[model samples]
Target: MKDAWKRWGAEDERGALNLIGPDEVRRAVSLVKSGEVVSLAQPLSSKTPGPKHRCGLQHFMNRDGGDYAAGGRRPGGFQFSEDSVVMPLHIGTHIDALCHAWYDDELYNGFAGNSIRSTSGASRLGVDKMPPIVTRAVLLDFVQLRGKPLAADYSIGRADLLEAAAAADVQIGRGDAVLIRTGWLESQTGVTDVSFDIEPGIDVEAALWLAERDVALIGADNYAIEVLPFPAGKVFPVHQRLIRDYGVPLLEGLSLEEIASRKRSTFLLMASALPIVGATGSPLAPTAVL
Candidate 1:
Protein backbone atom coordinates (compact mmCIF):
# COMPACT_ATOMS: atom_id res chain seq x y z
CA MET A 1 0.00 0.00 0.00
CA LYS A 2 1.27 3.45 -0.88
CA ASP A 3 1.67 5.92 2.00
CA ALA A 4 -0.57 9.05 2.08
CA TRP A 5 2.16 11.26 3.52
CA LYS A 6 2.91 13.04 0.25
CA ARG A 7 -0.79 13.37 -0.57
CA TRP A 8 -1.49 15.22 2.66
CA GLY A 9 1.82 17.12 2.61
CA ALA A 10 4.69 17.11 5.13
CA GLU A 11 3.27 19.37 7.87
CA ASP A 12 -0.10 17.59 7.83
CA GLU A 13 -0.94 15.68 11.01
CA ARG A 14 -4.73 15.23 10.99
CA GLY A 15 -4.58 12.60 8.21
CA ALA A 16 -7.89 11.33 6.77
CA LEU A 17 -9.80 13.68 9.04
CA ASN A 18 -8.79 16.40 6.62
CA LEU A 19 -11.35 14.89 4.23
CA ILE A 20 -14.18 16.00 6.52
CA GLY A 21 -14.96 19.56 5.55
CA PRO A 22 -18.00 21.87 5.81
CA ASP A 23 -19.85 19.95 3.09
CA GLU A 24 -19.40 16.66 4.87
CA VAL A 25 -20.56 18.12 8.18
CA ARG A 26 -23.61 19.56 6.45
CA ARG A 27 -24.35 16.19 4.89
CA ALA A 28 -24.10 14.58 8.33
CA VAL A 29 -26.52 17.12 9.72
CA SER A 30 -28.93 16.32 6.93
CA LEU A 31 -29.05 12.66 7.97
CA VAL A 32 -30.72 13.44 11.29
CA LYS A 33 -34.39 12.41 11.11
CA SER A 34 -35.87 11.75 14.53
CA GLY A 35 -33.23 13.65 16.48
CA GLU A 36 -32.88 10.54 18.66
CA VAL A 37 -29.41 10.13 20.16
CA VAL A 38 -27.58 7.02 21.34
CA SER A 39 -24.35 7.06 23.27
CA LEU A 40 -21.50 4.98 21.91
CA ALA A 41 -19.47 4.86 25.12
CA GLN A 42 -19.37 2.12 27.72
CA PRO A 43 -20.02 3.30 31.25
CA LEU A 44 -16.95 3.64 33.42
CA SER A 45 -16.96 1.54 36.63
CA SER A 46 -14.42 1.05 39.39
CA LYS A 47 -15.43 -2.56 40.01
CA THR A 48 -14.58 -3.69 36.48
CA PRO A 49 -11.01 -3.34 35.31
CA GLY A 50 -10.36 -2.36 31.71
CA PRO A 51 -9.08 -4.78 29.08
CA LYS A 52 -5.52 -3.93 29.95
CA HIS A 53 -4.11 -4.65 33.38
CA ARG A 54 -3.44 -1.67 35.70
CA CYS A 55 -5.79 0.51 33.64
CA GLY A 56 -8.85 0.43 35.88
CA LEU A 57 -10.59 3.58 36.91
CA GLN A 58 -10.28 4.94 40.44
CA HIS A 59 -12.80 7.35 41.92
CA PHE A 60 -12.74 9.65 44.95
CA MET A 61 -15.40 11.84 46.46
CA ASN A 62 -15.15 14.94 48.64
CA ARG A 63 -18.08 16.07 50.72
CA ASP A 64 -18.73 19.17 52.80
CA GLY A 65 -19.16 18.87 56.55
CA GLY A 66 -22.64 17.72 57.65
CA ASP A 67 -23.25 20.23 60.44
CA TYR A 68 -20.32 22.64 60.20
CA ALA A 69 -21.17 25.20 57.50
CA ALA A 70 -18.47 27.77 58.12
CA GLY A 71 -18.93 29.74 54.91
CA GLY A 72 -22.71 29.47 54.71
CA ARG A 73 -25.67 31.32 56.24
CA ARG A 74 -27.13 28.15 57.78
CA PRO A 75 -25.69 24.84 58.94
CA GLY A 76 -27.45 22.79 56.26
CA GLY A 77 -27.77 25.51 53.60
CA PHE A 78 -24.36 24.94 52.06
CA GLN A 79 -23.77 21.33 51.09
CA PHE A 80 -21.85 20.18 48.08
CA SER A 81 -20.15 17.12 46.75
CA GLU A 82 -17.19 16.90 44.40
CA ASP A 83 -15.54 13.94 42.78
CA SER A 84 -12.49 13.10 40.68
CA VAL A 85 -11.46 10.17 38.54
CA VAL A 86 -8.14 8.73 37.42
CA MET A 87 -7.64 6.36 34.53
CA PRO A 88 -5.65 5.84 31.37
CA LEU A 89 -6.62 7.92 28.37
CA HIS A 90 -7.39 4.78 26.36
CA ILE A 91 -9.22 2.97 29.16
CA GLY A 92 -12.71 3.26 27.69
CA THR A 93 -14.10 4.03 24.23
CA HIS A 94 -11.30 6.12 22.75
CA ILE A 95 -9.65 7.25 19.51
CA ASP A 96 -5.99 6.60 18.86
CA ALA A 97 -3.78 9.44 17.68
CA LEU A 98 -1.55 9.33 14.65
CA CYS A 99 1.46 8.97 16.92
CA HIS A 100 0.04 5.92 18.67
CA ALA A 101 1.70 3.44 16.24
CA TRP A 102 4.49 3.32 13.68
CA TYR A 103 6.41 0.99 11.36
CA ASP A 104 10.11 0.86 12.23
CA ASP A 105 11.45 4.31 13.13
CA GLU A 106 9.17 6.77 11.37
CA LEU A 107 5.67 7.94 12.28
CA TYR A 108 2.98 9.46 10.08
CA ASN A 109 4.24 12.36 7.98
CA GLY A 110 7.72 10.88 8.31
CA PHE A 111 8.38 12.17 11.82
CA ALA A 112 10.99 10.34 13.90
CA GLY A 113 8.95 8.12 16.20
CA ASN A 114 11.57 7.89 18.95
CA SER A 115 12.30 11.61 18.95
CA ILE A 116 8.66 12.70 19.46
CA ARG A 117 8.30 11.18 22.97
CA SER A 118 8.75 13.31 26.07
CA THR A 119 7.78 13.34 29.76
CA SER A 120 4.56 15.18 28.87
CA GLY A 121 3.62 13.04 25.85
CA ALA A 122 4.32 13.02 22.12
CA SER A 123 5.38 16.38 20.76
CA ARG A 124 3.97 15.55 17.32
CA LEU A 125 0.68 13.97 16.14
CA GLY A 126 -0.76 13.98 19.66
CA VAL A 127 -4.47 13.46 20.32
CA ASP A 128 -4.94 17.18 20.91
CA LYS A 129 -4.17 17.81 17.27
CA MET A 130 -7.26 15.85 16.22
CA PRO A 131 -10.35 17.96 15.74
CA PRO A 132 -13.94 17.13 16.63
CA ILE A 133 -15.37 14.55 14.20
CA VAL A 134 -18.81 15.27 12.79
CA THR A 135 -19.68 13.29 9.71
CA ARG A 136 -21.82 10.59 8.14
CA ALA A 137 -21.44 7.27 9.95
CA VAL A 138 -22.28 3.80 8.67
CA LEU A 139 -22.72 0.63 10.71
CA LEU A 140 -21.71 -2.68 9.19
CA ASP A 141 -23.24 -5.31 11.46
CA PHE A 142 -21.14 -8.44 11.03
CA VAL A 143 -23.06 -10.30 13.73
CA GLN A 144 -26.25 -9.98 11.71
CA LEU A 145 -24.43 -11.01 8.57
CA ARG A 146 -23.06 -14.16 10.21
CA GLY A 147 -26.40 -14.83 11.93
CA LYS A 148 -24.43 -15.30 15.15
CA PRO A 149 -21.52 -13.89 17.07
CA LEU A 150 -18.25 -14.37 15.26
CA ALA A 151 -15.61 -16.57 16.77
CA ALA A 152 -13.09 -14.86 19.06
CA ASP A 153 -10.26 -15.28 16.56
CA TYR A 154 -12.23 -14.46 13.41
CA SER A 155 -10.36 -12.10 11.13
CA ILE A 156 -12.67 -10.02 8.93
CA GLY A 157 -11.22 -9.33 5.49
CA ARG A 158 -11.93 -6.87 2.67
CA ALA A 159 -14.58 -9.05 1.05
CA ASP A 160 -16.41 -9.47 4.35
CA LEU A 161 -16.64 -5.70 4.79
CA LEU A 162 -17.98 -5.19 1.28
CA GLU A 163 -20.56 -7.95 1.69
CA ALA A 164 -21.73 -6.55 5.01
CA ALA A 165 -22.14 -3.07 3.55
CA ALA A 166 -24.11 -4.41 0.59
CA ALA A 167 -26.31 -6.49 2.86
CA ALA A 168 -27.08 -3.50 5.02
CA ASP A 169 -27.77 -1.31 1.97
CA VAL A 170 -25.36 1.26 3.27
CA GLN A 171 -22.98 3.19 1.10
CA ILE A 172 -19.40 3.64 2.22
CA GLY A 173 -18.82 7.28 1.48
CA ARG A 174 -15.68 9.34 1.66
CA GLY A 175 -14.81 10.91 5.02
CA ASP A 176 -17.36 8.71 6.74
CA ALA A 177 -16.93 7.00 10.10
CA VAL A 178 -17.44 3.25 9.72
CA LEU A 179 -18.42 1.25 12.80
CA ILE A 180 -18.36 -2.54 12.84
CA ARG A 181 -20.39 -4.63 15.27
CA THR A 182 -19.01 -8.07 16.14
CA GLY A 183 -21.52 -8.77 18.95
CA TRP A 184 -18.51 -9.33 21.20
CA LEU A 185 -19.40 -6.51 23.56
CA GLU A 186 -23.03 -7.62 23.82
CA SER A 187 -22.02 -11.19 24.78
CA GLN A 188 -19.81 -10.03 27.61
CA THR A 189 -21.18 -10.01 31.16
CA GLY A 190 -18.15 -8.43 32.75
CA VAL A 191 -14.67 -7.21 31.96
CA THR A 192 -12.97 -10.25 33.50
CA ASP A 193 -12.39 -13.06 30.98
CA VAL A 194 -13.67 -10.79 28.22
CA SER A 195 -11.16 -12.45 25.89
CA PHE A 196 -8.80 -9.55 25.51
CA ASP A 197 -6.27 -12.17 24.51
CA ILE A 198 -8.13 -12.76 21.23
CA GLU A 199 -11.09 -11.15 19.50
CA PRO A 200 -12.56 -10.74 16.03
CA GLY A 201 -11.50 -7.65 14.09
CA ILE A 202 -10.55 -6.29 10.69
CA ASP A 203 -7.50 -7.67 8.91
CA VAL A 204 -4.79 -5.79 7.05
CA GLU A 205 -6.73 -6.20 3.83
CA ALA A 206 -9.73 -4.51 5.39
CA ALA A 207 -7.50 -1.72 6.62
CA LEU A 208 -6.23 -1.09 3.11
CA TRP A 209 -9.79 -1.20 1.81
CA LEU A 210 -10.89 1.53 4.21
CA ALA A 211 -7.85 3.61 3.36
CA GLU A 212 -8.72 3.38 -0.31
CA ARG A 213 -12.20 4.63 0.49
CA ASP A 214 -10.76 7.62 2.34
CA VAL A 215 -12.54 6.84 5.58
CA ALA A 216 -11.91 9.36 8.33
CA LEU A 217 -12.17 6.89 11.21
CA ILE A 218 -12.92 3.24 11.89
CA GLY A 219 -14.53 1.86 15.07
CA ALA A 220 -15.56 -1.51 16.42
CA ASP A 221 -17.22 -3.06 19.46
CA ASN A 222 -14.11 -5.06 20.32
CA TYR A 223 -11.15 -3.81 22.34
CA ALA A 224 -8.87 -3.38 19.36
CA ILE A 225 -10.26 -2.45 15.98
CA GLU A 226 -7.85 -4.89 14.32
CA VAL A 227 -7.45 -8.61 14.94
CA LEU A 228 -5.10 -9.53 17.77
CA PRO A 229 -2.16 -11.96 17.50
CA PHE A 230 -2.26 -10.80 13.87
CA PRO A 231 -1.49 -12.93 10.82
CA ALA A 232 1.67 -15.07 10.92
CA GLY A 233 4.88 -13.03 11.32
CA LYS A 234 3.02 -9.71 11.30
CA VAL A 235 2.96 -7.43 14.37
CA PHE A 236 -0.01 -5.05 14.40
CA PRO A 237 0.21 -4.60 10.66
CA VAL A 238 -3.27 -3.04 10.50
CA HIS A 239 -2.34 -0.43 13.08
CA GLN A 240 0.93 0.35 11.36
CA ARG A 241 -0.74 0.79 7.98
CA LEU A 242 -3.82 2.73 9.15
CA ILE A 243 -2.32 5.01 11.80
CA ARG A 244 1.25 5.38 10.62
CA ASP A 245 0.70 5.19 6.86
CA TYR A 246 -2.81 6.38 6.09
CA GLY A 247 -3.22 8.48 9.23
CA VAL A 248 -6.66 7.00 9.96
CA PRO A 249 -7.61 6.96 13.63
CA LEU A 250 -8.95 3.84 15.27
CA LEU A 251 -11.86 3.73 17.75
CA GLU A 252 -12.03 0.78 20.11
CA GLY A 253 -14.25 -0.52 22.95
CA LEU A 254 -17.33 1.11 21.43
CA SER A 255 -20.83 0.47 22.80
CA LEU A 256 -22.66 -0.63 19.66
CA GLU A 257 -25.08 -3.22 21.07
CA GLU A 258 -28.01 -0.83 21.36
CA ILE A 259 -27.54 0.57 17.88
CA ALA A 260 -26.98 -2.84 16.41
CA SER A 261 -30.18 -4.12 17.96
CA ARG A 262 -32.07 -1.27 16.33
CA LYS A 263 -30.78 -2.40 12.90
CA ARG A 264 -30.10 1.05 11.59
CA SER A 265 -27.31 1.19 9.03
CA THR A 266 -26.82 4.95 8.79
CA PHE A 267 -26.58 7.69 11.39
CA LEU A 268 -24.83 10.89 12.35
CA LEU A 269 -21.75 10.41 14.54
CA MET A 270 -20.33 13.13 16.71
CA ALA A 271 -17.21 12.71 18.80
CA SER A 272 -14.75 15.28 20.06
CA ALA A 273 -11.49 14.20 21.58
CA LEU A 274 -10.43 16.03 24.71
CA PRO A 275 -7.63 18.48 24.03
CA ILE A 276 -5.17 16.72 26.29
CA VAL A 277 -1.90 18.06 24.99
CA GLY A 278 0.76 15.49 24.14
CA ALA A 279 -1.52 12.52 24.90
CA THR A 280 -1.58 9.62 22.47
CA GLY A 281 -5.32 9.07 22.88
CA SER A 282 -8.42 10.51 24.55
CA PRO A 283 -11.36 8.97 26.32
CA LEU A 284 -14.48 9.99 24.39
CA ALA A 285 -18.24 9.83 24.79
CA PRO A 286 -19.29 9.49 21.17
CA THR A 287 -22.96 9.84 20.31
CA ALA A 288 -24.93 8.61 17.33
CA VAL A 289 -28.00 10.50 16.28
CA LEU A 290 -30.59 8.68 14.25
Candidate 2:
Protein backbone atom coordinates (compact mmCIF):
# COMPACT_ATOMS: atom_id res chain seq x y z
CA MET A 1 0.00 0.00 0.00
CA LYS A 2 1.07 3.58 -0.63
CA ASP A 3 2.16 5.85 2.23
CA ALA A 4 -0.89 8.04 1.61
CA TRP A 5 -2.91 6.75 4.54
CA LYS A 6 -2.64 9.60 6.98
CA ARG A 7 -3.35 12.65 4.82
CA TRP A 8 -6.55 13.31 6.72
CA GLY A 9 -4.80 13.09 10.13
CA ALA A 10 -4.28 10.10 12.40
CA GLU A 11 -7.54 10.41 14.33
CA ASP A 12 -9.71 11.44 11.41
CA GLU A 13 -12.29 8.87 10.38
CA ARG A 14 -14.37 10.57 7.68
CA GLY A 15 -11.45 10.47 5.21
CA ALA A 16 -12.03 12.18 1.84
CA LEU A 17 -15.40 13.36 3.05
CA ASN A 18 -13.48 16.10 4.81
CA LEU A 19 -12.93 17.68 1.41
CA ILE A 20 -16.62 18.44 1.06
CA GLY A 21 -17.68 21.83 2.38
CA PRO A 22 -20.21 24.55 1.74
CA ASP A 23 -18.64 25.40 -1.61
CA GLU A 24 -18.60 21.87 -3.02
CA VAL A 25 -22.25 21.39 -2.08
CA ARG A 26 -23.25 24.69 -3.61
CA ARG A 27 -21.52 23.74 -6.84
CA ALA A 28 -23.58 20.56 -6.99
CA VAL A 29 -26.82 22.37 -6.27
CA SER A 30 -26.13 24.86 -9.06
CA LEU A 31 -26.24 22.05 -11.58
CA VAL A 32 -29.75 21.06 -10.52
CA LYS A 33 -31.83 22.90 -13.11
CA SER A 34 -34.86 20.68 -13.72
CA GLY A 35 -35.14 19.16 -10.23
CA GLU A 36 -35.75 15.70 -11.66
CA VAL A 37 -34.95 12.96 -9.10
CA VAL A 38 -33.40 9.89 -10.65
CA SER A 39 -32.94 6.77 -8.58
CA LEU A 40 -29.49 5.30 -8.77
CA ALA A 41 -30.01 2.06 -6.88
CA GLN A 42 -30.84 -1.41 -8.09
CA PRO A 43 -33.85 -2.80 -6.23
CA LEU A 44 -32.75 -5.54 -3.87
CA SER A 45 -34.29 -9.00 -4.14
CA SER A 46 -33.52 -12.69 -4.37
CA LYS A 47 -33.12 -12.09 -8.08
CA THR A 48 -30.58 -9.26 -8.13
CA PRO A 49 -27.33 -10.60 -9.55
CA GLY A 50 -24.65 -10.91 -6.87
CA PRO A 51 -21.61 -12.96 -6.00
CA LYS A 52 -22.42 -16.45 -4.80
CA HIS A 53 -20.41 -15.91 -1.62
CA ARG A 54 -23.37 -14.02 -0.17
CA CYS A 55 -27.01 -14.97 -0.64
CA GLY A 56 -29.52 -12.44 -2.03
CA LEU A 57 -31.83 -10.48 0.23
CA GLN A 58 -34.58 -12.43 1.96
CA HIS A 59 -37.50 -10.04 2.50
CA PHE A 60 -40.67 -10.78 4.47
CA MET A 61 -43.53 -8.75 5.80
CA ASN A 62 -43.68 -8.48 9.58
CA ARG A 63 -47.28 -7.16 9.54
CA ASP A 64 -49.89 -7.20 6.83
CA GLY A 65 -53.54 -7.98 5.92
CA GLY A 66 -52.63 -11.64 6.50
CA ASP A 67 -52.83 -10.81 10.19
CA TYR A 68 -56.48 -9.80 9.74
CA ALA A 69 -57.24 -13.19 8.17
CA ALA A 70 -55.57 -14.82 11.21
CA GLY A 71 -58.06 -13.32 13.70
CA GLY A 72 -56.19 -10.08 14.08
CA ARG A 73 -58.16 -6.86 14.48
CA ARG A 74 -57.27 -3.29 13.58
CA PRO A 75 -57.52 -0.65 16.29
CA GLY A 76 -59.58 2.45 15.35
CA GLY A 77 -59.83 1.07 11.80
CA PHE A 78 -56.12 1.72 11.31
CA GLN A 79 -54.18 -0.72 9.20
CA PHE A 80 -50.58 -0.79 8.14
CA SER A 81 -47.97 -3.21 6.86
CA GLU A 82 -44.33 -3.64 7.74
CA ASP A 83 -41.58 -5.68 6.16
CA SER A 84 -38.09 -6.77 7.16
CA VAL A 85 -35.03 -7.45 5.03
CA VAL A 86 -32.40 -9.94 6.09
CA MET A 87 -29.17 -9.94 4.10
CA PRO A 88 -25.68 -8.60 3.87
CA LEU A 89 -25.38 -4.84 4.06
CA HIS A 90 -23.95 -4.93 0.55
CA ILE A 91 -26.98 -6.49 -1.08
CA GLY A 92 -27.40 -3.85 -3.77
CA THR A 93 -26.13 -0.38 -4.58
CA HIS A 94 -23.98 0.57 -1.55
CA ILE A 95 -21.06 2.56 -0.19
CA ASP A 96 -17.99 1.01 1.38
CA ALA A 97 -16.90 2.42 4.69
CA LEU A 98 -13.16 3.01 5.11
CA CYS A 99 -13.14 -0.16 7.15
CA HIS A 100 -14.21 -2.33 4.22
CA ALA A 101 -10.63 -3.12 3.08
CA TRP A 102 -7.19 -3.10 4.53
CA TYR A 103 -3.63 -4.40 4.16
CA ASP A 104 -0.48 -4.78 6.28
CA ASP A 105 -2.52 -4.92 9.48
CA GLU A 106 -3.69 -1.35 9.23
CA LEU A 107 -6.88 0.35 8.09
CA TYR A 108 -7.49 3.88 6.86
CA ASN A 109 -5.80 6.66 8.83
CA GLY A 110 -3.71 3.96 10.48
CA PHE A 111 -6.52 2.29 12.39
CA ALA A 112 -5.21 -1.08 13.53
CA GLY A 113 -6.68 -3.82 11.42
CA ASN A 114 -7.34 -5.76 14.61
CA SER A 115 -9.64 -2.92 15.59
CA ILE A 116 -12.08 -4.64 13.24
CA ARG A 117 -13.18 -7.64 15.28
CA SER A 118 -15.72 -10.23 14.21
CA THR A 119 -17.42 -10.05 17.57
CA SER A 120 -17.76 -6.24 17.70
CA GLY A 121 -17.20 -5.08 14.12
CA ALA A 122 -14.94 -2.12 13.33
CA SER A 123 -14.00 -0.08 16.37
CA ARG A 124 -13.38 2.82 14.03
CA LEU A 125 -14.40 3.88 10.52
CA GLY A 126 -17.59 1.86 10.37
CA VAL A 127 -20.48 2.80 8.06
CA ASP A 128 -22.06 4.60 11.00
CA LYS A 129 -19.20 7.08 10.87
CA MET A 130 -20.02 7.99 7.30
CA PRO A 131 -22.05 11.12 6.86
CA PRO A 132 -24.60 11.67 4.14
CA ILE A 133 -22.74 12.56 0.98
CA VAL A 134 -24.10 15.51 -0.95
CA THR A 135 -21.96 16.87 -3.71
CA ARG A 136 -21.38 17.53 -7.40
CA ALA A 137 -21.14 14.33 -9.37
CA VAL A 138 -20.15 13.73 -12.97
CA LEU A 139 -21.03 10.67 -14.96
CA LEU A 140 -18.44 9.17 -17.23
CA ASP A 141 -20.55 7.08 -19.59
CA PHE A 142 -18.07 4.61 -21.01
CA VAL A 143 -20.98 2.52 -22.28
CA GLN A 144 -21.95 5.11 -24.88
CA LEU A 145 -18.31 5.69 -25.71
CA ARG A 146 -17.68 1.98 -26.19
CA GLY A 147 -21.12 1.33 -27.68
CA LYS A 148 -21.40 -1.86 -25.65
CA PRO A 149 -20.64 -3.43 -22.30
CA LEU A 150 -17.01 -2.99 -21.42
CA ALA A 151 -15.24 -6.22 -22.32
CA ALA A 152 -14.94 -8.76 -19.51
CA ASP A 153 -11.84 -8.07 -17.36
CA TYR A 154 -11.45 -4.70 -19.09
CA SER A 155 -9.23 -2.24 -17.22
CA ILE A 156 -10.27 1.40 -17.23
CA GLY A 157 -7.24 3.67 -16.84
CA ARG A 158 -6.50 7.31 -16.13
CA ALA A 159 -6.53 8.30 -19.78
CA ASP A 160 -9.95 6.77 -20.25
CA LEU A 161 -11.27 8.88 -17.36
CA LEU A 162 -9.66 12.01 -18.76
CA GLU A 163 -11.16 11.36 -22.21
CA ALA A 164 -14.61 10.82 -20.76
CA ALA A 165 -14.42 13.94 -18.62
CA ALA A 166 -13.18 15.94 -21.60
CA ALA A 167 -15.95 14.62 -23.81
CA ALA A 168 -18.53 15.36 -21.15
CA ASP A 169 -16.97 18.84 -20.77
CA VAL A 170 -16.94 18.67 -17.01
CA GLN A 171 -14.16 19.40 -14.58
CA ILE A 172 -13.47 16.73 -11.98
CA GLY A 173 -12.40 19.02 -9.21
CA ARG A 174 -11.85 18.40 -5.52
CA GLY A 175 -14.78 16.93 -3.56
CA ASP A 176 -16.70 15.94 -6.72
CA ALA A 177 -18.35 12.54 -6.94
CA VAL A 178 -17.57 10.54 -10.08
CA LEU A 179 -19.90 7.78 -11.19
CA ILE A 180 -18.66 5.65 -14.05
CA ARG A 181 -21.21 3.57 -15.93
CA THR A 182 -19.83 0.49 -17.60
CA GLY A 183 -23.26 -0.94 -18.43
CA TRP A 184 -22.13 -3.90 -16.35
CA LEU A 185 -25.04 -3.79 -13.89
CA GLU A 186 -27.60 -3.01 -16.58
CA SER A 187 -26.34 -5.93 -18.66
CA GLN A 188 -27.20 -8.47 -15.98
CA THR A 189 -30.39 -10.36 -16.81
CA GLY A 190 -30.38 -12.81 -13.91
CA VAL A 191 -28.39 -14.54 -11.19
CA THR A 192 -27.24 -17.16 -13.69
CA ASP A 193 -25.42 -14.45 -15.61
CA VAL A 194 -23.61 -12.86 -12.69
CA SER A 195 -19.90 -13.51 -12.43
CA PHE A 196 -17.61 -12.35 -9.64
CA ASP A 197 -14.73 -13.92 -11.59
CA ILE A 198 -14.90 -11.17 -14.19
CA GLU A 199 -16.19 -7.62 -14.70
CA PRO A 200 -15.06 -4.38 -16.33
CA GLY A 201 -13.76 -1.80 -13.84
CA ILE A 202 -11.17 0.83 -13.00
CA ASP A 203 -7.51 0.08 -12.56
CA VAL A 204 -4.97 1.48 -10.09
CA GLU A 205 -4.17 4.26 -12.52
CA ALA A 206 -7.73 5.49 -12.54
CA ALA A 207 -8.05 5.17 -8.76
CA LEU A 208 -4.90 7.20 -8.16
CA TRP A 209 -6.17 9.94 -10.46
CA LEU A 210 -9.38 10.28 -8.53
CA ALA A 211 -7.65 10.18 -5.17
CA GLU A 212 -5.26 12.91 -6.26
CA ARG A 213 -8.22 15.08 -7.14
CA ASP A 214 -9.47 14.56 -3.58
CA VAL A 215 -12.79 13.24 -4.76
CA ALA A 216 -15.22 12.75 -1.88
CA LEU A 217 -16.77 9.63 -3.37
CA ILE A 218 -16.25 7.22 -6.26
CA GLY A 219 -19.19 5.11 -7.45
CA ALA A 220 -19.79 2.80 -10.36
CA ASP A 221 -22.59 0.73 -11.86
CA ASN A 222 -20.74 -2.53 -11.27
CA TYR A 223 -19.87 -5.10 -8.64
CA ALA A 224 -16.37 -4.25 -7.44
CA ILE A 225 -15.02 -0.85 -8.31
CA GLU A 226 -11.85 -2.40 -9.72
CA VAL A 227 -11.56 -4.76 -12.67
CA LEU A 228 -11.92 -8.46 -12.04
CA PRO A 229 -9.63 -11.49 -12.70
CA PHE A 230 -7.53 -9.61 -10.19
CA PRO A 231 -4.92 -7.50 -11.98
CA ALA A 232 -1.73 -9.48 -12.49
CA GLY A 233 0.11 -9.74 -9.13
CA LYS A 234 -2.74 -7.85 -7.42
CA VAL A 235 -5.77 -8.88 -5.44
CA PHE A 236 -8.33 -6.09 -5.18
CA PRO A 237 -5.46 -3.62 -5.15
CA VAL A 238 -7.74 -0.74 -6.01
CA HIS A 239 -9.91 -1.41 -2.99
CA GLN A 240 -6.91 -1.52 -0.68
CA ARG A 241 -5.31 1.57 -2.17
CA LEU A 242 -8.43 3.71 -2.13
CA ILE A 243 -10.20 2.55 0.99
CA ARG A 244 -7.32 1.63 3.23
CA ASP A 245 -4.56 3.82 1.89
CA TYR A 246 -6.42 6.90 0.68
CA GLY A 247 -9.61 6.94 2.75
CA VAL A 248 -11.90 6.87 -0.30
CA PRO A 249 -15.02 4.71 -0.29
CA LEU A 250 -16.36 2.69 -3.19
CA LEU A 251 -19.99 2.80 -4.34
CA GLU A 252 -20.99 -0.28 -6.26
CA GLY A 253 -23.99 -1.84 -8.05
CA LEU A 254 -25.67 1.39 -9.08
CA SER A 255 -28.41 1.85 -11.69
CA LEU A 256 -27.28 4.72 -13.89
CA GLU A 257 -29.30 4.06 -17.06
CA GLU A 258 -31.99 6.61 -16.29
CA ILE A 259 -29.64 9.50 -15.63
CA ALA A 260 -27.53 8.60 -18.62
CA SER A 261 -30.54 8.59 -20.89
CA ARG A 262 -31.30 12.18 -19.97
CA LYS A 263 -27.97 13.16 -21.56
CA ARG A 264 -26.97 15.21 -18.55
CA SER A 265 -23.42 14.30 -17.56
CA THR A 266 -23.34 16.45 -14.45
CA PHE A 267 -25.81 16.74 -11.61
CA LEU A 268 -26.43 17.10 -7.90
CA LEU A 269 -26.01 13.81 -6.05
CA MET A 270 -27.40 13.02 -2.60
CA ALA A 271 -26.69 9.71 -0.93
CA SER A 272 -27.11 8.54 2.67
CA ALA A 273 -25.86 5.19 3.80
CA LEU A 274 -27.75 3.16 6.38
CA PRO A 275 -26.33 4.13 9.75
CA ILE A 276 -25.17 0.63 10.41
CA VAL A 277 -22.77 0.89 13.32
CA GLY A 278 -19.60 -1.16 13.05
CA ALA A 279 -20.55 -2.43 9.61
CA THR A 280 -18.24 -2.43 6.65
CA GLY A 281 -20.80 -1.01 4.21
CA SER A 282 -24.44 -0.02 3.76
CA PRO A 283 -26.98 -0.29 0.98
CA LEU A 284 -28.08 3.02 -0.49
CA ALA A 285 -30.91 4.13 -2.71
CA PRO A 286 -29.04 7.22 -3.82
CA THR A 287 -30.79 9.92 -5.83
CA ALA A 288 -29.53 12.27 -8.49
CA VAL A 289 -31.30 15.58 -8.91
CA LEU A 290 -30.81 16.56 -12.50
Best by lDDT: 2
Candidate 2 lDDT over 1-290, as tens digits, reads 65465676778889989888999999889998888899998888877766788888888999999898897888898888999988888778989999999989988888888999899999899999998999998899999888887897789999999999998998898998899999888777554767778899999989999999889889999889889988678899999889988888999988999899999998999999988889999999999998
Task: Evaluate all candidate structures by whole-model CA lDDT and list the values in order.
Answer: 0.86, 0.89
lDDT of 1 at 115: 51
- Model 2 / residue 61 / CA error / Å: 1.8
Worst 10 residues of 1 by lDDT: 66-75
**Against the true structure, what is each candidate's TM-score?**
0.93, 0.96
Model 1, span 1-290: residue lDDT tens: 44789677878889999989999999999989999999999888775436656568888765545434555334456566677888888776888999898977898988888856667688889999999999998999988899988888899999999999999897797899999999777777655656676888999999899889989999999888888767889888888999999999999889998888777898899999999998889889999998
